[model samples]
Target: MICVDASGVRLAQPDKVLFDGLDVTISRGDRVAVVGVNGSGKTTLLRILTGALRPDSGEVRFGRGVRIAMLEQDPLLPPGTVADYLGDGWEVAAVATSLGVLPLFDRPTDQLSGGQAKRVALAKMLAENGVGAAAEHDMIVLDEPTNHLDLEAIEWLEARLVSMSAALVLVTHDRHALDRLTTQVGPSKVVELDAGRAFVHQAAKGSSAYATYLDARAERVDREAKEESTRKILARKELAWLRRGAPARSTKPKARLRSANEIVSGGPRDLGVRGNDLELGAGSTRLGNQVVELVGVGQRFAVDGSDAVTVFRDVDLVIEPGARLAVVGPNGSGKTTLLDIIAGRRAPALGQMKVGSTVVVGYADQHAASLDPDITVRQMVAGPLREPDHEDKALLERFWFDSTAQYAPTRMLSGGEKRRLQLVMVLARKPNLLILDEPTNDLDLDTLRSLEEFLDDWPGAVVLASHDRAFLDRVADHVLAIEPGGTMRRVPGGVTGWLEERSTRRSASPVRTTKVADAATSSSAGAGASGGGVAAGSRGKQKQASSGPSPSTIGRRLRETEQAMVKAQKRVDDLHAELASTADHVVLAQRGEALAVAQGELDELEARWLELAELQDG
Candidate 1:
């Protein structure tokens, strides 16, 4: 079923049409993810799709009885209880409980933080879908869904997406979400809108649609290479003729004489622009008895009726020397709360927390707000170094901060540049412990990758919270999964394993078989293997299969199917638990129906998998 078919969509910008004569079709069961850099009209396209704004000359047709739900970048909730906004329905109550928003049901929405508000908005949206009973809506759209969410909320949201039956259209920066959810669904098709025309391309798996731009870039490089080669050959021939006295028999070989003069006058000169060679010296600092320790730590913000709304409770954690730990959870699941406690920014409500005596903590918040907008990059770096006249100029240049940019105020720098500056300033102090929150946000992919490379070599211990799965996989050595109810669990294999486990849960297949196939396909075909007969191919296949069936392989596949079923069960359990724990009448009633559906899915998947396993065993 087509949810929306938009054609001739146009936007006014850059004194040109953004996407005039454009056409797009969103259908049921489609998980379409839109990706582009900032200012690339992603949000504008979303607005057009949702019918919030009209196209300049086109029509947007919605399927019959399609109930579209959209989560905006900044979702607004009314200043009433969550239950009140959600109509006190049993379905609403059930979604709220499972999403860990049950505690906020009776509390005023105005008291909720940005993260909490987003969670509430998501719950409300899901509740409107009849608490995942059936796809009443043809489609649901989410923009930047993971923004402002804690690690736990993000995980819950990811789980919710996996269990959702309706078609989803999402625009997000969360790489893990894109990789996992998109894997469960399929590759995102691109509807490239350029110069009043739209071109649709079927993106390949594991490759972004934006790669078309790279293809264009490669063509440009090829053209430049041909031009350079022709110029060099012509110059060489001309020089050879000129050296032979311009062909004594011919009248002064005009072309050869002209070419020689031109070469002499316009010879290439070294511009003295050195390539990027950033050298961060490896240094170590002694970590005292305890780098950081949190025992029964809890935090709550004061609100009416509730003494304090607990973000986390009874959490115990420790960061020893050289520990590269990662904290993950959903939007409001207390990853930030734990980070704040570690950074000495927030005191734990009910437990003891300590930092080592000699520890110097360098904290980088998501917004890079620690920077002084008024100061120049040189001044910022030199401020702490206390050596303005020293090698600070060279250091700034090495980080790609040009001379002019180095003198410009921090406010004038781009987001990536600012992040680089932040790194330069923080590393100048060479703190033994680094606390980074959402460090990959707003950073370009190159810078994100570079930072990961830098962190790998850095000797300092790191405690980071990031939604960038690739970055986390590269940097984090240990993973902490924070769930609702303030429970923190140490997950094995860091971010890669956590994501693999999550993907396994959603895919209903063994992760190992898929990975093995992928690995085999990616291996290079040797000269002999490339054109060899069927015998060579059979041998290759045998070799590939022989490399198989480790315990992790089976576990991953089982875990994926198991995780989906388990997640459904957990949602149902959360509803029951909420009903028993809270006196909120509306919430208790609302959860009853949602619990039934979740229990149904759990029962079905469980039985199906068990039967399959038993048949194999038999």
Candidate 2:
């Protein structure tokens, strides 16, 4: 059944056309994934679909009794308690509990942090669960749902969506979700919006539709390139004719002459196509051998003016030159605080934190406070530098802000644009040590990819705290985790390794509590709250009293061992493929190292499988 259909849609922003004569249909059970470069109107299309905003032209028709629940990228909730807002529905409570926001039921909604508020808002939406009597089936629209979610929460949300009996439309940059969760329902279809036009590819369900769309898009790109080449050739001829001041030029229509001129001057811009050679400029500072050091460094805080809490204790870590570390933990875990401490914005309550003399830190916190809404793009780019100059203009253009936008106010820029400007401001200083707290929060796919590419070869020390699994895997060489009870440990296996462990833990313990759920009351919750740490980790090590697998548990152990082996081998194969295809010297070196690690892990898995097999045979 058709849930909603949009026909002849048109939306335009004074200077740019967002959508023109676009058509879209969302049917029941359809899991549509909307993807495009930033400013390509994905969000606007979503708003149009839900009928929250009317398009300049066209009509959106909803099937009888179509109830829509939307999770906007940033939602506004009226001031009230979380419970007051979500109502007392069991399903809603269950979702809130699972999302780790049940503890905030009594907390004023307005007082919650941005991340907390996001979770609360999501919980309220999921609480609806698309099962109300108002509609035949609920249509759920989510924009960047995983932006603030941790690995475990993301996994839980993915599970919930898979089980949900509703039509789902989402916009996200998470490749994993696109591959794993979403699948075409009924007839296969792909609806991709590029600039204002919609391109639909029909094929088999699952990845086949996505694959077909990509192939078709690539062909279109090739054809356009060829057409542009021909246009340029003709434009050059026209220029020569015009230069001669021929009498024939006067007979030609002025509009035709203008078109010829535009063709000669780089032609009319296709805002949708960004030249792949996007540069994130400003090389980093020359780092000395030492970057930063923490000796017995720990943080603690007083909660309710009584009990003292430990964020982390007796943590010893050294940030080496050109090091890449990803800080990870549950919500409220001192990931942000940790970054602040390392960046010298905050001092450790205990132990010594030392910064290398050569280190000039560039910090971009979650709040993006460095940005000034009243300032123009040029002003923001110039920042502390004396004045905006030609170089600054060039830099802004490189980051995708054209001449007009460079002079426009920063407040008018889209979320993605603001993030791009923020990045420009941060990197322009050429700091040797870079600390990014949730940097991927507002960045679009293009910007995220560009930043990841830049960081790959950046000659500096970097520390990032983010929940983006793809981003973490691409950029982090190591991981610093704040486990429950404020135990800070350097985990093995970067983000991938940590993810595997997390998955295992979820399977072993079905009911896990994040710091957001247990922060106020648990003894160590105070430590997590006071020290600004997150209370999440393995439920300690599971006790293995038996030397070998017990007869009752042997079957489970055998299955687990087999699964682990398969996963390890897959990692080895993926690493090998990456190593073979990569051309960048730095990337090849990184992949080579990853291949070695995967090989070692595969060997260990094989050894463990053999041990488990022997135990079962006995």
Candidate 3:
């Protein structure tokens, strides 16, 4: 059954067309992911689909008795407490609890943080789908649903969405969620928008459709370039012939002359600058042996102006030169606080923190709060240098800030453009110690990829706290996991290890298994894993799971651990051979790193096997 059908949709802005002749039919169980560059009309399309905005020339029809709900990028709420805003329902309570917004139930909605508000909005939508009711939303539309969510929350949402019966349509920059939610088979479709044109691609549920689209798009661009080059050559020849200015040419047919003129006047094309051109050049200064050192660092805050709540404690770590540390934990696990301590923005209540004198910290928070809206782009970049020059203009151009944009007030820039400007400003300082807290928040995928490439070879220490799994996988070589009870543990496989541990925990629980299928397979893998402490009733069961393994479980785990160790060792061996054979320095470095990671995984597996073996022997 068709839930919603949009026919001959056409919309335009004063400056340019957003989309033309767009036809989309959303049927029962259809999962569509709308993707494009930041301003390529993703949000606009969502608004149209949800009926918030009507296309200039299109008919939108909804199936009878088919309810729909939308989670806007930034939703507005009436004056009330968080709980009041959500209303009374078990599903609402469950979703709030899962998203770690239950604690904010009594908190006024107006006072909620951006992340808190987003979570509340998401929970409200999820609740409306009706947890176990006979009737649920037939179609659900979400725009950037994962924007402010942490990895755990994202995984949970993925799980819930997988278990949901409603058809899903979403627009997001989160590649992981996109891959999980949509598929080539069935009714899943990847609708890509480019330059006012829409291209639909069919890809499998777990496939990297976005990546595939990028490759296909690049090939198409190359082909067009080659065709254009041929035309340019003919145009040049025609101009050269016309320049002869012979009397015979004047006598030639007017039509021939007109064709000649058209060819000659084609002119040189614009370079078509892109986000990839943005150069986040490494800092001029080199980092010292010690960038930051923390000993027994702990942070606690008073909750609702009452009893002190421990966020994290007894943390010891060192940030050395060229170190890349990825922080992972549930929301409210103090990841941001950890970065704050390292950046020296906030003093830890019960720990000693030291920063080297030469280590200049460049901190980019979620919101580009350091930027002044009144200033122009050129002014912001040049303000720190205290002068504007040809060099500054050149730098701005590299970051895609044209002369017009450079002169425009910062407020006139889009969210992505503003974020890029903030990035340009931060890197201008040439800080040796770079700390990013949710740096991907407002960034386009192009800029995000460029930044990742920049950091790969950057000669400085990096501390990144982000929920972007792809970013973490590309940037981080090690992981600092803030576990429950304020204890920090280093995961051997970086993001891979953190995910593995979470996977194990989820697989072990029968309740979780029913709620969240494996993240690798399901559209949603997180429905119940909340960063908020477990409910009072579940604490005992959680404690039991945390305790030492039982006899039968130990034997089973021992066998699995042994098998994993063998596989890991084999992987390490393969990487070593590849590293030895590789001639390119870049390839060699990558293989070497892979070997090290494989060896670390092997070691961890061996250790786990030993522990299980000992328990089984007893």
Each prediction's TM-score against the native? Answer: 0.56, 0.79, 0.76
Candidate 2 wrongly placed segments (more than 4 Å): 130-137, 184-191, 201-203, 208-213, 249-259, 265-268, 271-282, 514-618
Please give, for residues 1-618, the per-residue lDDT of candidate 2 as tens digits: 788998998889998778688777888777777766667788888888898899999888998988888888888888889899988866776788777787788899888887788888888777767356232337888998887787778878888887677888888777666555555444445567776677767666545555676679888888878888899789889888778764544655576677667778776436354654344424666777667877666777775576666776656666776567788887776788888889998899977877778899998777654467788889887875588998788777778788999999877877767777787777777788888988887676667777787776566767899888888888775677777666666565667777788778778977766443243335342111111111112222232344542332443455556668889889999888888887999999999988899899889888887887676455
Candidate 2: 10-residue stretch with minimal lDDT:
526-535
What lDDT does the true structure give each of the candidates? Answer: 0.64, 0.73, 0.72
- lDDT (tens digit, per residue) of candidate 3 on 34-134: 87655568788988887889999979888887787888777887799988888877777778766777767888989987777888998888887866764
Candidate 3, lDDT over the whole model: 0.72
Model 1 lowest lDDT segment of ten: 527-536
- The Cα RMSD in angstroms, rounded to one decimal, for candidate 1 relative to the true structure is 22.1
Cα lDDT tens digits for candidate 1, 351-397? 78777888988888765655898988889988854656556776676
Residue 297 in model 2: lDDT:
68
**lDDT over C-alpha atoms for residue 266 of model 3:** 72
